[model samples]
Target: MRRFNLKLYLIFILVLLVRISNAHQETIRVGFIESPPLIYNKDEKLVGALVDYLNDILPNFNIKFVKTPLSRVPDLLDKDVIQIFPMYFYSAERADKVHYIPTSFHALNPCLCALKENKIPSTIRDPKSFEQKTIVHLRGTLKNRDFLNFKNTNYLELPTQDYYEKSLKMLKLKRAEYAYFADFQQVKRFLNNKKHSNIHCENSHYPKDEMFFVTNKNFYLKKNLELKISKTSFKTYLKKHLSRVNWQVD
Candidate 1:
């Protein structure tokens, strides 16, 4: 009986050590972009709604965040250089490379901004009405697919400089009659500038798209995240975070 008791005690100690080692294992690296109020760097620290949400909910999870240019996220995910990415919408090409969490983390409302000096209509009610009207947008992006179908609208695609302010500046400069498509919050932030007061953003016409998290297919936390997010508090936290952007959770 004494020998049997000794073996059990050793087995228990070994199991406890193994569990502790696993618990303290290397932190998972999460990649994000500077889509503020969603995720962005401020004062050299990662700060934003998503950052706050993760901080609040994942106390037990070991996570290390990495901020990079939003443009590079796709390639980085493909190479599995980053284990996880947050707040991205589903695309067929992305789907091919990464596995998405089953639930949408939040939604975004993309809007169009036009300069008041140009007498551009406040809203784009009819696609056909865009004929001959010049629309400026960030180069390498074609987010407004429905509006693009009306090829009659002249496009002045501009290169991005890690921000959308330049695209709005072009509209202010009258380089284009209107600038089309950005997250409503981004447009609001741009127009808040005194110089951009001449710009009017049309929130009436926009697309409401759901955003999700993507991870390398082999990421260990992929399954665990699905479980964590299903909790009531997780969704409540998400709703609270998005509320800052005037987004409602259904």
Candidate 2:
């Protein structure tokens, strides 16, 4: 009788443990900023290359995406509002706020774009070349430190709503002489629109930079998430997804 009772007690504990584990895996909140082809809303559904990749790789976890502006991402992560940010460029400043998965999923090449009629130089070997030039970019995406090399250059920052296209339009309208973009591939994709045909981007002079998945510092599953991301062929998946949207992966 005592043996039967002990067996039932053990079974109950096992069931409870399993329930707890399942609960923990049920939902993981992921934060995203609206960057087309990477992450965006379409037809009332969250869909994009980064979204598809995360959904495919994390089949076991129920993901809830929280869309926020780029500037608020660090605060959201620090406050534990989200467990993961599926795609982000690495910076020492960001690293202090969140932990990055050691493996990089993609590479980006930064470039300067301007209307062909503007006749900006094709390559920028020296920052002085842009002296007194007016540049536009998405606010919070680029900083004065990024342009520490270029003194006296005018910077016009715009909000993130359709930023890529808007930045190009600003150049076409002569509001800015150049548009600085962090990802050459993203700029290339946007340039496919006939309206932007006159815009030409300078060849990237900087070495390719890698982007990684980042998690809140306090996230409990950071190690497991890192191992999963490191083991997956994320680059291949990203390339395939981007290609579907006519965006090249580099």
Our model 2 lands, by Cα RMSD against the true structure, at 7.2
Residue 170 in candidate 1 has what lDDT? 73
Predicted structure with the largest TM-score when compared to the true one: 2
lDDT of 2 by residue, 1-250 (tens): 9999999999999999988887887788898877767776666777777887887778888889997666777788888788788767778888888788888877778788888877665455456767888889777766424563576778898877767767877887888998888788777876784446777887546556677888877788888877777777766665665655533222
Assess each prediction's global lDDT (C-alpha) against the native: 0.67, 0.75
lDDT tens per residue, model 1, 1-250: 9999999999999999989987886676788655655665555666567777776556666778876445667677768677778767767776877889888777777667777766555445576668888888755445535667676888777654444666666776777777765577656754564356677777655667677788878777787787766552444654554445422111
Score every model by TM-score. Answer: 0.71, 0.80
> What TM-score does structure 1 among the candidates reach?
0.71
lDDT of 2 at 33: 73
List residue ranges in candidate 2 displaced over 4 A: 1-25, 121-125, 144-149, 246-250
The global Cα lDDT (0 to 1) of model 2 is 0.75
